[model samples]
Target chain A: MIKKSLGIALFTACFLFALCVGPALSADSVKIGILGPFSGSLAFNASEMKKGMLLALEEVNDAGGLFGRQVELVYGDTECKPDKGVGAVKKLLTRDEVLVVGGGYCSSVNIAASQIADMEKCPVVVAIAISPTITNRGLEYVFRTSPNSPMFLNGINQWLEKVKQAKTVAFFMENSDYGRDGEKIWSELSKKIKAKELAHLYFEIGDTDFTTQISKLKNLNPDVTFNIASTTEAALIQKQAKELNFVTQWIGVGGQFTEAYFKMTGPISQYAMGSSLEPTLNMKSPETAAFVEAYRTAYPDSRPGIFSSQGYDNLKVILDAVQRAGEPTGDLQQDREKIKDALEKTDMKLTQGRITFEDDGQVHSVVPSVVQVQLENCEPELRIIYPEDRATADYQAPQPWRERECQ
Target chain B: MDSLFLQQVVNGLIIGSVYSLIAIGLTMIFGVMRISNFAHGDYAMVGAYVAVFVMMWLPGPLGWVNALLAAAVIVAVAGVVSELLIFRPLLDRRTDIDMIMVSIGLFILLENLAQFFFEARPRMLADPFGGNTVDLGLVSTSQLRLFCLAFSCVAIAGLQVFLNRSKTGIAIRATSQNSRAARLMGIDINRIYTLTFGLGSAMAGIGGVLYGTLFAVYPTMGAIPTLKAFVVTILGGMGNIRGAIFGGFILGVAETLGGSYLAMEYKNAIGFVIIILVLLIRPQGLFGQREGV
Candidate 1:
């Protein structure tokens, strides 16, 4: 009886081992690393990015597994710190042995991680970090799928000239890489457009008070106040601006004026304008609509933002590159180079728009959309107002403050 | 230079008032219980959330007042519960380190629970004064900030009165001075502990409400202020109320001046540096009594 029990235990142990290690050890498998701020101030955004990437992976796997090889993703949590980001990239490259690394919601963290990828000769596909310095560093291995600050700033400038016809502008930028880069881009474009810089107010990340900054802006009194900050900071600034009776036009960038922003700031978000690389409202394309529906079905609780969609597109680009590179024959370095070359050479249409990379690894073509905040039944809705060819709603600029004329 | 200096000083005072409000509870708790509650910040966070919820339900002028009251009551209840469930049981063990660890655990638990409920969104509580600025000719200040300063002064005076006159407050002070002797003299140590915890949490709640009004409310919003409060409490000498008030104002001034002159990013670092300097100069703190005194 003892001998029979021992044999049975050994058989069970062997079965469990195989069950756990079978897929990981399979020869026809491609592994990619996803690193981001999973447990810090930016965890919510990171979670959204992860969910979107996972959904894209699921779709790719369902459609025959990336050229007959199953794609695998390994996640690294950077906690939004530069040192942690560097450590995460090392772990992904050395421990997980992933060919292509993706993820990073913060610009500083992304820059740190990208440095490691460059040193290790691994391709890093960034999803939504908009610091222009990330691409400006000229790292051949680093490629960002999201539009940089220059693209968004240029788009906003064109819209202001053609659509809004605004003359002067006020700048309220956060003191971070994303905000500073955005301000620099805006400064260059404002010079070209001959827009006056009325007030240039700056605040640190995690700063709660904005009375001083708002007061300065109110005194300077420009045509519009451009809030180039995170969603939370922008919400606070906007609310303060309204309370101070500084009823200037408010324009934001990079999906800052969304449902969450409006909810946080309450009625202050009304009439705010935001520019997004991803379509905000009236997604008319059947393919885009289908993707959105699938995403909604998968994550019923969380809504997909522009960054989430960009994350999904980044994953698709990497997976497509791996599939085109064909199966690897135990040579990871060669496979990585081939995949990088394929990523640079390919042209694919994602849920957002056409995906083609420039020589510097930035998205070549993107559809920029402008959205206006409108109150519907006491709830804020981002009504698309630009690109009349694709607009589903008419633009109604908030009546100028002069016309309202408070007693 | 004069305009910048005056502005910095005003900024310091406004920010100092906030620090004093946050550190008052820490001072009270340390004075009475001799236990450093690491979860004080989490209580502040809970108060901020409660204020937000109340503000959403009640609109206009009454909203701000109700939010403050609601936060105080909710945080007081939470403090009582924590005392009954965690502190009372740990008292018999005489394990101060274990209690500190438990407080840390509570801090993390409360922060995570807040994240779970709030989903990491930073919310702006409506400024009741409508961003009205009061220009004193020399410097300008916001109505909300002036209100905070006035509230802090009132709160400090009220606390002084309570500590001096109230029977429960006397028992708390007696327990802090000599716990074993107080217990021998027929004082209910448990009740005093509970009262101290409640009082401390109430102070934190008030701080939270004011903070939410002045700034934005987020799950991790209490962390930086809490750290600053710790520095203030330490510099003030643990258990010294007046010292805490002085330390808070001093640290605030130092931070503001540092930010204005040196670098804004290093504002938080100034508090730590002051704490280190105090530790090196006077190990017992600026206002602390000598050991065995």
Candidate 2:
């Protein structure tokens, strides 16, 4: 009689274990975690990205969903800080138990989030952070849908040589990881392009003034001033640069291609070419066209920019991987493994360009470009001027502030 | 001197004037009331946004005049409301920290409220002085900076004249000296408190309008100035009006030169380092003395 009771208890224990683990592995709703600075200083980019990602997500869910399960977006607000990002990602993985994660507008925040997601073995599809080292770390579970930071250097330097004839290059950078990366690349490549580089200028994030930096730059008088600052700082520098008359050919690097720069600087923003991961407004991918149209229709009060395109494409990459992984078979570990394997082999055409990954998980299909906002008939028109094939307008030789028509 | 050095000095003075305007208001408030009013910065931020909106609505050149006038009056009224509703009720607090905590709460409340209404994105007030510069022989300065300097000088002079010569000003100073004694001498301490707070807030409002005109106006615009005001107050001797003005110029010049010669990243450190050095020499600050002084 004692033996019979023991056998019955063991059987119940096995049943309870299965009951506990089953739903976690296979649920009717596929939980995908999205994170970024949804509030705070980066909110402008975050809002644009959220809108873009949501648009893609709705379309994906509407089209029979991923793996025949409904897609649900669970969000984590990182506030664009590294430590905050780690905490947010932890909750998303441990509490929400998200099967997939998508987001990253700041490089520092993304690097931190990816580390946490890596430990949990959760696949994170990166949207917009541009640090090259993020992919070079050899994390199998991490994939990026945006161009890396250094990718802009060669293109920018090439354009500088071919068009501008800038002999000396000056760098005004933010004192952060992405900005450091920019400084490193520009300094390294400037020698290759036979251009002399001046001492690197730096500013902390959120500083309103740049008079000192402007004074120094004007004194040194480099031919091309490469400003690797955030969107707000870029606006501040350009606005002050015009006032100070220090307008060497300004080549704005990452995170500066937002609408705010043009909106705030107005005519002063003219003739400044910026490196961007998003395809120009006239890029003819049917998916890009549809995304832009839908974004406009949905957010009439807002104008979508680079983050919007990156967010949409990042979602597409993640959803495609999930679709390949198929329905959860009540084994989360097994399904996660399948999703990782499927993400490795992901190859498709999406917004911006064709979407595919290299061995290091950097998206090889996304082509970065340089775009200029010109006044055509007294209205701002964005034009792509790089790589020639995608050229909507010929690259104009950059001139000093004294020569520009805007002055 | 080279143009760069000359340019930096001019830049320093321009920034100095704005700092002086903001710090004077903060020092005045702290002088009369023991409350730190940490939300002083947010008050400036609110004023800046109000100024921006006024400019947007008024159209063309009058927007500048209207923004400044409206911001000063509106923010002054808000200060009266803030004191009556917030500080007046908290007068019987258990400790000064409670009032500080309240001010901090006000800081967060005002910042978030501005964000909620204005959105987190920065709003730029169309500057009547943007893209224009004045030739000062050795170097040129932006018209915006010149305008800011000119406005601050007028405002500071006006405030000084009022404080020195007017009946209300004397009553305010008496309350600052001894609220209990002033109350016994037939001065309405609460009325003095209300007037002082309003005047201080009006100063912040003008500072805000000028700040918004020069730099971008956003919810967090006042944070740095507010912090710098603390430094300026401590450097000038807390609650000493003249010292705040002196500290503002000193801090601004030190920051600009330090940023130029030392490093831009450590620009903020320059002011603090000076503060540390100053405290070591004069515990009372450059102008600080006894409570009455």
Candidate 3:
């Protein structure tokens, strides 16, 4: 009886959800699905991504919407799960009947949603997720505005080669697809540089205690440690490493540079090198300055992360395609095809840099900068120290940490 | 290698002590009420938030002490509220499963509520303890971790004393053993349940504050600890406090040693594996008194 009741309750909840979010077809508006996580651990970044997309929507409408019709954004919250993302994409494609889609925050979620979009022939503009495999999936509808791991790997290798000091190395890989790619790249690169790969360690995404891992690492005593964890995990690991007096020349492929990393680790995060998409200190392009200013003006209380910037750029790319598509003609199928065709030939300059994608809808060789966590003007910031033209600061190796004073 | 071994051991012990507090509370609730109290971790989360406020409002040398007390008291109050509002209503149904279901519901509700209020971003307390280390021969132990270990031991010992000596604690124990007999002896079972819940929640509260100081305070921060607590409970038996402590340490040491010896990827998974081995060897738990069998 309890099982029966539970089934009934679940059915009712689903029915209610469908009723509440009933597909409203607007004949005078062009509908585009915006996919992102609205809940879960990643919900915070997803919300930021949403804010960026919302800003883009208003901007597009302000300067006259696509095909002389107001663009209506249909948001699909995937909650950062692969299965849930596919479900969101299904709802967007079939129920909402969206002509085009924008936004894919988490790499795993984005890849799942984009895979579905490919099957449905709906164009998807990828924002934040930077796993190279997502593009390598051979999906025609999926196009990433952000740089991938292979691109960041080049920057990382370049920086490491320039230093020429790291002969023995260790890697702390998160047991996820993103980390798997990093492990592959870093492991292969170790052979090229003839560095001793002491240990290729792994940890769960949300594991708080890194003491045990660091204890094992301390014993191995590698000269350099390559970290491939998320922003929080990276910060926590670094903080614990400092506490344990297990200091090394820290290196990260991507996903470590953040305001939270500095705030959480404080001065201890100093001199750690990592690859980043965000131009933390020096804005090479005028557009980056304007984007930052506009973001700050819009969200006074909060600071936008790299994900938010990616969201904004992705939307702009999608809008560029919509304008290039020229006319909607009130037919959803034809309008979608037109957007897809236009997106294929998308060549434009944006805040990050000149944005373009190959036939596989992936941006390769975007030239990410090797940045060091450094103190500038009494604030901790990522100072780009590689790619000489983009370098705002010089590279600094991890300094021997001072003994922590008692309270 | 010797230095690393000692460091890992110290790390395991420090982290294990915190796990013991959380597990003891969970075990106490299950022992008396037979309710799993899956939302116990969220209770810890609530306490951590309370600590954050307390620290901010009252800043000085004894600020952290006051923050800890405030966290425990506030979380204890929250615990009583959960009992009065949810558990008390479901007691008439005569089903332990109903109470467990309510706990799961409470967990989801509390997590979402915390997420709504706190957001998903992690918040950290200003380091009152700072990042100071006290070298113990071969291994350097952080002052903050030492504080967490010492506080957890004191709290657990105090709870043990309360159970052995206090009249109310005896009544609670009686209720756990024979509810009908306790009821006939004029001891209110409902009151006992409420006290047990509040006490258990307060223990979790202490764990939460320490967690916030050492690691971070976030909405979903309680998740992994809760899973580990469950594993500890299994090793210590369902509702035994002494067993919870032993089990927590055992699991912690096992995880640390396993991670070091085998693979770091198996760090979290190793504890569960140990629990499985223990279950296969002796089902009554290491400290569990064989009741019927």
lDDT of 3 by residue, A1-407 (tens): 56446546754774685476545667678788888877665666677777777778888898788767788888888776789999999998988888788888667777678888888888888877778878888887788888888887788787677765588999887787777888888888888889999998899767889998887888888988988876678888877887787778888865666556666777777777888777335365787777777888988876666766778888889888988888777677787889998998888776667788898897653567788878765466777888888788887655555642211
Clashing pairs in 1: none
- Each candidate structure's TM-score, on Cα atoms with residue i matched to residue i, is 0.80, 0.91, 0.93
Best by DockQ: 3
User: Any runs in candidate 2 off by more than 4 Å, and if so which?
Assistant: A1-29, A62-70, A328-335, A398-403, B290-293
With candidate 2 superimposed using the best TM-score fit, by how many Å does residue A232's alpha carbon deviate from the native? 1.2
Instruction: Note each model's CA RMSD in angstroms.
Output: 7.3, 9.4, 3.7
Candidate 2 lDDT, B1-293, residue by residue in tens? 78889888888888988999999989998889877888887778878988888877886568888888898999999999888767777676437898888788778777766776787787788887646766565666678788888889888988888988998888888887778898999998888889989999989988888887788887778788788888888899878889999888888888888999888879888888888887898877799885445
lDDT (Cα, tens digit) per residue for candidate 1, span A130-200: 88878778888888888887777665677787777667888887777777787787777777778888766
Candidate 2: Cα lDDT at B278? 78
List residue ranges in candidate 3 displaced over 4 A. A1-29, A67-72, A280-282, A326-331, A403-407, B59-61
In model 2, state the lDDT of residue A125: 84
Q: Which window of ten consecutive residues has the lowest lDDT sum in model 3 chain A?
A: A398-407
DockQ of predictions, in order shown:
0.20, 0.27, 0.44
Weakest 10 consecutive residues, lDDT, candidate 3 chain B? B85-94
TM-score values for chain B across all models: 0.96, 0.95, 0.95
Rank all candidate structures by their DockQ, best first, as comma-separated numbers: 3, 2, 1
